[model samples]
Target: MGAGPVYGQEVVLTAEVDLAEIVRSKYDFDVAGHYSRPGIFQLTVDESPRSVVARKA
Candidate 1:
């Protein structure tokens, strides 16, 4: 992946899972299918010059 610092605007992360067997199987909880579960991903972003505001003392 190319690091386009000057060109990059924003970054986002998304996750999803398959709910086929998980819906029918009785595996305690709904977790029968092996897929990418929706989870929270933290990403550090550098704000643009226009978006960043300087605090005046």
Candidate 2:
């Protein structure tokens, strides 16, 4: 939890794999991975890659 304020992200993706690239380049994680299954994923990023793509979107 937060002592005062905190920002968090939780991603459950079924498609839109393009967003996955943005996330892969942005956040630094200690330990992370995926299942062999194709579309199932858990992902997020803190660097706000959306800002990089916002103008295009």
Candidate 3:
């Protein structure tokens, strides 16, 4: 599960379980635990939102 164009400096993807790792490894993003969600991970790339969105899965 994922959504957003959070309008920040990084491309942030909210993915759960195996999906999180897949996104991170596939895209070379860094994976971190979501602040408020269990079993969910945040994959982040330090880049413009528009640029990252273009690389969507």
Candidate 4:
């Protein structure tokens, strides 16, 4: 079989907040399913300003 897909570089960050917990607590949302499957969530610096203001308000 041919190669399944081409892969690009990857970057990982260790942030202070637990992203999954924040999403569940703030929005009542869950990225991982009932079995706790792994998933990806993307947050960019562009959202930082708006997020900060939202938290303050």
**Model number with the top lDDT:** 3
Tell me the lDDT of model 3 at 16. Answer: 55
What TM-score does structure 2 among the candidates reach? Answer: 0.16
Q: Candidate 4: which pairs clash?
A: none
Better model by TM-score, 2 or 3?
Answer: 3
Per-model TM against the reference: 0.20, 0.16, 0.18, 0.17
**lDDT of each residue in 1-57, candidate 1, tens digit only:** 334345456765454656785766666544534432445333468776564577879
Model 4 weakest 10-residue run by lDDT:
33-42
Off by over 4 Å in 2: 1-17, 27-57
For candidate 2, lDDT tens digit of each residue in 1-57?
A: 223333486544353346676777655542444443346755566775465355644
Report lDDT (Cα) of residue 36, candidate 1.
Answer: 29
What is residue 55's positional error in candidate 1, in angstroms?
32
Residue 2's C-alpha lDDT in candidate 2? 20
RMSDs, each prediction? 13.4, 17.3, 16.8, 17.3
Error of 2 at 20 (Å): 0.5
Clashing pairs in 2: none
| Model 4 local distance difference test score | 0.51
Using TM-score, give the best candidate's number.
1
| Tens digits of per-residue lDDT for model 3, 1-57 | 557767847875775577677766855543343444545754577675564355547
